[model samples]
Target chain A: MDAGLIFYGSAIFLMVMGVFIAITGRHLIKILLGIDVFDTGLNLLIVSFGYINGGTAPIFSKYPNIFKNVVDPVPQALVLTAIVIGVAEMAMGLAIVMQIKEKFGTCNIAKLKELKW
Target chain B: MIRRLIALLVSLYLGYILYSFVYVHFPFGERPLRGVAAHYVENGIKEEGATNIVTSIVTLYRGFDTLGEVTVLFLAATGLGLILAGMKREEEEKPEPTLIMETVTKHLFPLVLLFGSYIFIHGHLTPGGGFPAGVVIATGYFMMFIAQRSFTPSEYLLSATESFAGTLYVIVGLLGLALAFSFLDNVMPLGIPNRVFSAGIIPVIYIIIGFKVGSEMTGILLHLKEA
Candidate 1:
């Protein structure tokens, strides 16, 4: 019922939803979107892992004493790197999809099963 | 129907496992700061002279990792460029931008660029940092693309800026190794905290990262658009 449970619950829900979408989606672009959703959920879970009951941000510009109740900075730093990498990955994935469509003449996963052998 | 049912079952099972794991090990909001995180929160300012602990961690405490991250980003962009090359160029007709869009972009473009620079310049003292600032700068470029169909950014300019920034970043890190204790160390004088130029090498490195990321992202956007 508390904030922690809510954060964890939503993160898990997003992860499950993303997995379902990835499993069931037919289009290549749809599958990519599902993967992005999963990425978002994982990021949410990581940030939440560093959460404290009422901790503030880890900045010390204004309130120096807040470090006593500051949330963990390591996870935040990790998420920062993850987000930039995610953008790069998304761009690469979309580029590959474009190439696939160009060569195969379709974006449907079922139609491009020529390599199933 | 079967695929959907199987997917549902898999998702449900995965969700149950994750939920139980969270419930058992990580009781929400009660994780005490320990080990490295504790040290960072407590002494990060003293060591790095940056008000933003996360910024200090990203650019200084774990700076080597950030260098590797930047290399990965560059590789991804280069790979995308390689993949998109040699495609059959199709001349698709495009419509002109609306009057409102053109006018808004004309007025807003400079402000966005200024804001992005501000973000990266003040990274040590504020919440925003290089990545977000670079994205914002790229967004400005994206807006220009949207407003003008003929707006093709010069490939030379983008690559030049990106390479220059990246090289400068390495040079700064090398300087740190030569002058200070290690690579990417704070060789510059740790100026007054809460100021724009505080945190020694942190702000300089962030500025380099900002330009590098901005140009790289803009190049990616251009490739996707051209493709």
Candidate 2:
């Protein structure tokens, strides 16, 4: 019934689903999508960590009780950085995937025997 | 079948661990604003003259991290370029965009660019900042790419903008080191809070970051498209 539990539960559920997709996905693009989902879930979890019961954003334009009511700005800032880095990482991953497809003429992970451990 | 089973087991284990850890340790919404967050919220207005506490923290209090973040983005873009460089270019005839798309893009490009600039320029006061603004600018460019087949963005120009913006950012940091207390320190006079041009170096830094990120992203998109 608690709001915190719902947020955490959904985040965890998404993360688990992402992991499953990443592990089971045969297509390279599917794996990439799975990773993206995982990244989103993690970002959501982090932003949720900064939530106060009824806190507003951490801005001071026209809000009263600035200190008492503002949510944690630190995690929000860190998440901003994280989101950018995630984009960069995704770009790099997709580039690698593109190269793999060009080289092997396939996007299926199961077909890439050389990559198998 | 075996792989799916393994994946299911692994995901189940991960979910169990995460759920248990979060349930036990973090009570989520009840988290009080304390520690560094409390300090920033308390003194952000006086110290940085920025109403947006997150902006102050990102641009001023923890600026070095931002510099590093930008460098990582640069590296990623460069790496993508390198990885895609060797592909042979095949000139395939592409269909022209629909009339509606062209019309909408022609009418919307300038507005999107203006809105992006506004978001970054008012980053210190508003919720949006350099990253989102830069993405918006890149989206505008992407629309241009999609709508106009002849619209080829000059690679040299994008690279030049990215490099110039990156260099300007470092120069601003060096200026801060020389004139102020530390690198990326607020050397400019902090004007009245909650106004445009009030956050001193914060807006300037955000603008530089906006340009840098925008060009870098455009370069990556171009590379991907060409490859």
Model 1 regions more than 4 Å off: A63-67
- Where model 2 places Cα greater than 4 Å from the true spot, the runs are A63-67, A115-117
Q: What are the per-residue Cα lDDT tens digits for candidate 2 across A1-117?
A: 888778888887888889999989999999988998998889888888888888989998863446468889998999999999999999999999988888889999787889442
- Error of model 1, residue B185, in angstroms: 0.4
Residue A28 local lDDT, model 1? 93
Candidate 1, chain A: TM-score against the reference = 0.92
* TM-score per candidate: 0.97, 0.96
Candidate 1 chain A minimal-lDDT segment of 10 residues: A61-70
Cα RMSD of all models vs. native, in order, equals: 1.4, 1.7
- Model 1 per-residue lDDT tens digits across residues A50-115: 998778899986734554888989999999989988998999999999999998889999999788
**Model 1 residue-pair collision total:** 0
What DockQ does each listed candidate score? 0.83, 0.80
Model 1 per-residue lDDT at B34: 95
Error of 1 at B25 (Å): 0.8
